[model samples]
Target: MHFELRDYQFLKVKQYLKQKFLLFSNGASQTSTNWLAVEQSLSKSNLKYYKVYNKIALKVLTNSVYNNIKQAIKGTFFFLKLDGNTNLLTKQQLFKKLKSVFFTLLSIKLNNKIYSIVQIKKIKSLNYRSNMSIFYQFLSANLKCVYGITYKKISKQCDLNT
Candidate 1:
């Protein structure tokens, strides 16, 4: 899933950071009276907090469709055209090559001084046993090292370790 942030929203975020405001929110809704009271109390103090509403629309694709598009873009089929032998590389070797390629694509450069702050929510929604879940854990750890990133599971019903 991908999200596109508008230029205006980016400007608003910049403005908030410039003003040194602490941002707080409980997802999309602010119906919780206790949270609102906390916000109000913080507003009265020197340290102020602004309530932010986030609206996210996700587009999900199945594994087959996603893999087809990825392979097409990456031109993985070019190998088949060069040599008709698809078994030139063993399954283990192919897996290792793909893993390295993905790691290279996802690696962050520390030379760049700018850092991004990322917040991931509802992580418990993902299947814990899936390879995608392990990939996310690796990605979260990688980003945490180079950038300010936080993972939050809002629901108290599930454990993060699971």
Candidate 2:
């Protein structure tokens, strides 16, 4: 979650970016480790890959990353902001979740209230995140209707009684 520090306010730009990224990557369960890299890659995939990261892949990453981040961190010190403000939490929980997100994206696991994001291994020959085809899965997920909308808009629309 990157943000522009305009004379000190730590505005919620990071939160908005974080939320939007999660919404876009809601399929694969992206851990907190490499959170920033994934975001940077997806944001600049056009330059990096000549196109936006696959919407389905992006949505998977967003959902997994955000969910992982939220669970590790509390639920107060956090609020989604986009131009205005959608603060629906406190600072403590907010910080915790964001921290967790970064760590989790990096593939770290939470243990005993402490984060351990350095013991990840790469020898598991397991099959994951590849079972579902992008076309069918995303189509079933309604990738067309909410395409290109910002996270804020998505959230607003997702809210009940709207």
Candidate 3:
């Protein structure tokens, strides 16, 4: 019965996505592994998605990405001064913003634990062809929505209280 319930949950998520390009994913935190499995399965289907996180979660995420809060602010200021959209600012203002964004994603901290970002060059597959649909889904699904706007929509009826 327990195993059947798990399968049911996975199937429900897949079906939900099949109907709507995006799934609300009320169970995202509990079903992390299900997401990986769904991504693997949906890799064949081309889909675009997005996720929304509140302000508090965003702060925590920032702290996690830059364990040293001081360094994070320094990096932010450095990048803004160098690449900020102002005619007065020039290339020599500070370090290159692009390089910092790329390099700084190496590690993130959560609950005092450091997590390293793994770069997998290639996925082992029976066919030589690459299926990047899963990558897109995963990337979009993790996107943090700003001010309740997940994506451009004609409708704006989301209840933010949840």
TM-score of every model versus the real structure: 0.22, 0.16, 0.17
Q: What's the residue-level lDDT of 59 in candidate 2?
A: 44
Report how far residue 41 has shifted in candidate 1, in Å.
1.1
lDDT of 3 at 28: 26
Ranking by TM-score: 1, 3, 2
Q: Candidate 2 regions off by >4 Å? A: 1-9, 13-19, 23-70, 74-103, 106-162
lDDT of each: 0.31, 0.34, 0.31
- Judge candidate 2 against the unseen true structure and give its global Cα lDDT, from 0 to 1: 0.34
lDDT of 1 at 23: 20
- Most accurate candidate by TM-score: 1
- For residues 75-120, write the lDDT of model 3, one tens digit per residue: 1111111112222322222113223222232232222333333321
Clashing pairs in 3: none
lDDT of 2 by residue, 1-162 (tens): 555544123223233334321211122345567645655643332211111223322343356543444432322122222222332433344335434343223222222122223322331211123323544676866865556456668788789546
What are the runs in model 3 whose C-alpha is more than 4 Å off?
Answer: 1-27, 56-162
Q: Superposing every Cα of model 3 onto the true structure, what RMSD results?
A: 25.2
Which order, best to worst by lDDT? 2, 3, 1
What's the distance in Å from true for residue 66, model 3?
32
**Cα lDDT, model 3, residue 100:** 26
